[model samples]
Target: MQLQLQTLPKVLSVLVMEDRIDAASAIQFKERLRDLTQEGDQRVVLDLARVQFLDSSGLGAIVAVKKLLGPDRVLELSGLTPTVERVFRLTRMDTIFTIHLTHEAALSDVTGA
Candidate 1:
């Protein structure tokens, strides 16, 4: 997985460049997230536009990220493709995450724009 970490004024954006988040990359994903968010206080927006596939491990990895962040910070998901969105919805994970149509929207929400 190619991950880009961008720290904005009031949010940290994590752009996922891969098309799939399966068991193979799940551990790496979680580790990378831990590293990327170690020093941030702003909300985290995970960009999933390129992620067309998300398996059980991927979902578990995301949940682990949330736990890693703890209660004070939040992790929102943005730019989900249809297939990815379906997985979240089908698994009832949508309610756990704040889903946005675009990365800009998620940024604006966190920055209070």
Candidate 2:
């Protein structure tokens, strides 16, 4: 559950420093995300470029984070691996989330820079 947190002007960027997000780490993932975002009102960008694998539990945890953020604060995902992207696509979760191809793109969209 190693995560790098970067606080930008308009966003809180959380870079997932793990290669896999599976059942074993799903709870930790959710807990860590919750802890990191508990005080922020800004948009959250979850950068998963290092994550090569994601299971259903992992996906569920992500969705839970979105819900936890409520309507005002958004949880955006970026830098998804091909396999992780496919899971989101197949599950149609892609439609529910604002996903960006890269971390820079997500920041650009939020910061309008």
RMSD of 2: 1.6
- Residue 41, model 1: Cα distance from true site in angstroms: 0.7
Candidate 2 residue lDDT tens string, 6-83: 998889999999999999999999999998999969899999999999999999999999999998899999999999
- Model 2 Cα shift for residue 43 (angstroms): 0.2
Return the TM-score for candidate 1, rounded to 2 decimals: 0.94
TM-score of each: 0.94, 0.96
Candidate topping TM-score: 2
Model 2 lDDT-worst window of ten: 104-113
Q: Write the per-residue lDDT of candidate 1 for residues 7-109, one digit (tens) a residue.
A: 8878889999999899999999999999889996988899999998999999999999999999999899999999888889999999889889999888878
* lDDT (C-alpha) at residue 95 in model 2: 100
